[model samples]
Target: MKNIILLVFFVFHISLFGRNLINPLNKSKDKNFSNIGLYIDGGTFGIGYSTFFNIEKYLSSSKSEKIHLFFRGSYGDVRFLGSGSGGGSFFKNTQTIGASITMITGRGNHHFDSSTGLFYRDESILPLLDLGYRYQKLNGGIILKGKIGILGLGFGMGFSF
Candidate 1:
């Protein structure tokens, strides 16, 4: 099930953002960026990574606020170390999958961001929300965001491609 979901996610990303597919809107500098970042907590409650794209910009509308739709997932290893009968350490892994929609408003490299989403993690469903700040370039470059909210405090670093 995990593999299948991951596969579907990758396929979805390719179909939507592949450079080979010619879209007239992609020519515009502001609309051409996609982001992938390593996140810690960030309302996810677990350490993982996320990828997102500018949906509104991709659709060719230059709205007051740009909306980004993020697809996030992770297979994380939780290790228990002890000095008991079992003697050493054991590894328990967990799977997480979620999607979020973020609204961002700003002119260029600085922006105010807010996000809300839901996730299935460790056999439980969780709600995520956050308000934050983002630093990223218009064409494509690095991405940095810090947020806090219902899920907790979180930070991310990645490149906008």
Candidate 2:
């Protein structure tokens, strides 16, 4: 997983400068205009998966080239999957739903995900940070990309059109 994440992130950065990808929200602003993709985030503290559907919109006008705010949420996770009648078994599964904001640095993208919801009759809070490059295709269709952070890394091919 680590290797795959690295490879994808490398490719995204290379594509940024090489293709002059449109960042939409520059670094100066306190928010990112719009972004829609699959969120794969986790941390060393927990052994679970996070799937998110995000939508970010710009709040101000900035020319520094950065992403500030991006609306985010994690659908749920498959932590528990087992069943028995004779001798019931035990498993752990969870899900999270919350809000998040981001701030971009100089070279890479920086963002965070915080979600809290009930999963399997249990309450939980899941927070994560992601740092990587986001690429926007020139054709204005779907954007294939990846993200690497302190928690877990994600490599996904998505669309922005």
Best by lDDT: 1
lDDT of 2 by residue, 28-139 (tens): 3343333333433333324533454433322222364432333343343434234212244444333333345544333233223222222221244444556555554322
Q: Provide the TM-score for each candidate, comma-separated.
A: 0.58, 0.45
- Residue 117 miss distance in model 1 (angstroms): 1.1
Separate clash counts for every candidate: 0, 14
Global CA lDDT of candidate 1, please? 0.50
- Among all windows of 10 consecutive residues in model 2, the one with the lowest summed lDDT is 113-122
Residue pairs with clashing backbones, model 1: none
Candidate 1, residues 38-134: lDDT per residue as tens digits?
A: 3333334444333222221222214433543344443332222321124333332334455555656676889887767765554566786679998
Native-referenced Cα lDDT, model 2 = 0.39
Could you tell me the lDDT of residue 44 within candidate 2?
Answer: 30
